[model samples]
Target chain A: MKMTKLAALAAATMLAGMPAAWAEGVKVGMITTLSGGGAGLGIDARDGFMLAVKLAGRDDLDVVIEDDQRKPEIAVQLADKMIQSEKVDVLTGIIWSNLAMAVVPAAVAQGKFYLSVNAAPSALAGKGCNPNYFSVSYQNDNLHEAAGAYLAKAGFKKPFILAPNYPAGKDSLTGMKRFYTGELAGEVYTKLGQTDYAAEIAQIRASGADSVFFFLPGGMGISFMKQYADSGVNLPVVGPAFSFDQGILGAVGQAALGVKNTSQWSKDIDNAANKAFVDGFQAEYGRLPSLYAAQGFDTANLLISAMNKADVKDADAFRAALKEADFPSVRGKFSFASNNHPIQDIYVREVVMEGDVITNKIVDTAMTDHANAYVDACKM
Target chain B: MSALLLIEQILNGLQSGVMLFLMAAGLTLVFGVMGLINLAHGSLYMVGAFAAAGAAAATGSFVVALVAALAAAAAAGALIEMLVIRRLYERDHLDQVLATFALILILSEGTRWLFGSFPLYLDVPDWLSGSVTLPGGIQYPLYRLAIIVVGLAVAAGLFGLISRTRLGIRIRAGEADREMIAALGVDISKLYTMVFALGAALAGLAGALVGAIQSVQVGMGEPVLILAFVVIVIGGIGSIKGAFIGALLVGLTETLGGVLLPQLFGLFMDPSAATTVGASLASMAIYILMAVVLIWRPSGLFGVRA
Candidate 1:
């Protein structure tokens, strides 16, 4: 009689559009770089993500976090584990573009939802766009394109441009050129992970450019800014916000002050959602929220918003619910473009001294309702 | 690039060469006095930088930071040399490499645990913050010029210590024949510890100095360590003089290759394509140099024949 009852319940669960499983909640797999050089960004994002999940107070939301060690092969292995054995319904929290590229395509193809907190690489935003994939952050080139627009507006005619010799780096320069209406003084690709920039500094000085633009993220940015400050060329510098993010600004110190960088969000966005996020994040983590942290928070809240409307087991319903994006975003207004990447305002922020703290403040809006250039290429 | 710009780049190369020398000097010394290959030398360098950053944060004195770096790294070096490395002398190179590599992981993890994953701020001193206009109208950073001077001075001092002092004679003797030195009433074990501490101190000093310009963070030492190994290999592992020359060669090849390679390619290819091809090639230039050096003299520039 017990066996027949169990079979009857299973049949009922299958027939009623999975109403019983909604109470059990969804399992989320978060793979991010939690160690090595990029650990600061990942740690902040993780903290912000967990904070939002905690605030939801949903005991049913189960999140499993893993460290990728900022390596691509390790990320692939971890993704395989998350999909095959752990049986996660949703996958998120990848910080680097290369790792996201490696894991996202496969995860979404396997019928699991992949919500990106950071690293919205162009390939996934365009031709590789999948219905199961949703990017909560701006596409990788969004900030760079904004920076290019701002550089032209600020009247930097002969700007020297450079980035690491990699796919994203190439994309960064290309995006910048799309909106930059100037004759480039020089465009040089430096070795990726090359810390010493004295040679590059000398090249910049010799290039006779009116200003400088570069897209070196993380430690590369810190090293370059500090070295550039000492190099004495002192041209006006502009780039994307990755280099000047909150987690890194402290290490760069006063050297980063007065530099203009483009971003999709800043702490001082002047909205109820953003203010709450900034305060809540600081109260929870005891550290300032970075751009990535905001993304993590938004991603978690979006998942929470979707969960309210549909059972995760019902793929069509869940996806449609996610597409609604009913959650109040910290970026004032947020929406998904047809490609599933974000369409939002990109702001120009100047690094400033908030007493002893180094941080950014919004100075200008570079683009309003800026959908990425590759959105048209995305059939999905 | 103009003649003035070229001169500035050459200076940059020289400055980088001297910093690499500081790292290679310690590695070469440790290898020469003891046949143990230490992959953990980079850990000691990292210890120095973290120690300096922590010290600098507390006292706001660059001098205190430097002193703290030297002391902390030397202490750590002595402690490890006694506890782990003393037992490794009897082991083979592979065993020593494995053990030292384990030490690297331990030290790196320990550092991460203590400092967290954020980089510490260690800026150049106020006096050394700006550029100095050198002869021929080249504007160079004062800190880098100071590094060049200090490195050359340290090189001279090391030569004096090795050739002139009684302890130096004993070190050279120990390098030549450790068993003979042990038999001849010399405290061979004590000598080894002193040598190791000395090497560690130099590495610490380098860390503190370069930390001012670079991001002082965990794993900062690993990249520099690779270059140092390349230098020691090119210079002949056991010879300090050779290490210095080898570092300069590597530094110059790397710096000049980055600047000139693109220009060379630009003559035939489009400017953008030239830059792409040139950068890819330039990244390989130093390794190519190492290969050529190895082909001519397998042992190294100053390495004694095996």
Candidate 2:
């Protein structure tokens, strides 16, 4: 009985010694795709975000992770559960734009802060933008626009553009055309989750396009690249970073090498925060950090910075602190636009084989201090 | 499109059709012989891909990988039949579906545990990595042509086995009358196990071949599995010839529809709008064909009237 009492006293003392910011215990609910086809992206994001929280070593912060299963309805249900039963102060980590569209508005409207680690849907950047919601990742169009800028600068006049037939796919093409001042030889929208690209490749070969721009993400990208390489169509390929990220690059292998992609972050970025993130991530996960991981790590640090400045319980004060964006972002200079979307530089990255491992190296800046076209449409 | 491009697209369609036939053949055979609905067939496909990928990565031999895929899928099928599937033979299709669905969850999670979340890489052999020129000067991937040849060879081999071999005779007899075959001193359970394993090996072969071209990861088999089911339904369940024909039809329709529909729509609407509509309709083309076939003949093209 005496030993039990002594142990309880010791535990109480240890708890009291923790930082005061953790006293109330900031509860963060993370809902991301943890299974299905796109599981790699979510897994990386979760690992990177958790790594940041672990490094911070804050006893007061509590995180609850849930799998969205890449389903919009399921994400909405999980968000509802997190907000009502879990009573989480913040919600973050949605990987797909469709799920984000379903979950974010309602969650933010419920007076909970939402820090998106990825998936900045155009709707959220426009009239649907909410003050309580902030995007740590690029707008859906930003990277595509960067790719377009790179292609235009390279003086490609006739390019074949392709994407999966979905909302994001349409946005990608629109983003590319926004910056591209050249004629499109062809614009094809393949079925989402299409595995075989033989028919499309045949058309591409026939179209007389000097270059190709595609936005097939995850397994779709892998299939397209392998088939493209095997088909021996030697046109220069450019795409958004979603396809060429570290998570799926190995599957793509030498086929992806020398292909240019656009992104906001790369492992080879010259910055102290990025160096720490890349090194720490590789040390922890034994793999190079992808752009998704960088976004997730930055998201956690951003929340921690806000938590340090103001208590989450004080809603207005916390909101103001978060708006200040006082954190060492992995991207080096991340700032929130008026609509709470990120305004930062997007870079062109070329996939290069370092020894045997396929990864990306930053080549050039495509866009500087870039903000989404929908920012002005946002009332807030 | 030019004539060369059209010819290439047709070849692509034929290639995809043949791959689908490889998957559909086993499924149709299993369903026709066993009267069992096995949703876990896709899991077996995934198993084959992972086994091949793991083997190729370790040994750097495509032949070893192919053999490993076949052995792994066959072994998994036999084990499942002995442990869990044998008991379900007397149960209804609903029970079989539920049990097999549980198996899918178990297999997927188990695979994730064994192979981490990231997709595994499987390289095409150097000899099969480049393109081959066709009669019309259109370049097609040699690997895809190889897949087509392999699939057709398997189809012929399956035909020979069923028509010429004693085991095939037993399998056909068992499918016709299980009790009669058992009473005739044939080992019914053993035959069932063999058939299941054979089907699994075929599925595995398809998985391994496709894995070389696409990402080999968990849940990779589901899309193919769905298409295989469609093929079997269109071809007529339990009919290998039907599966072959149905698979080819589905493949041709899917590829041609994707290309032709957009141009057809472009005559009326803007190119972007036409593409959106065309792609959407193209995805539904195979299903639409299935529905049309079913409407015309409820039992499918080759399926017998019950």
Best by TM-score: 2
Q: At residue A195, what lDDT does model 1 achieve? A: 82
Task: Write the residue-wise lDDT of candidate 1 on B27-91 in tens digits.
Answer: 99889889879888988999999999999999999989999999999998898899999999999
Tens-place lDDT per residue, model 1, A296-334, is 999999999899898899999999989888898999899
What is the C-alpha lDDT profile of model 2 across B116-176, one tens digit per residue? 8888898798978899887768788999999999989999999999989999999888778
Candidate 1 stretches with Cα past 4 Å from truth are: A1-21
lDDT of 2 at A207: 92
For model 2, the superposed segments whose C-alpha errors exceed 4 Å read A1-23
Worst 10 residues of 2 chain A by lDDT: A16-25
Worst 10 residues of 1 chain B by lDDT: B214-223
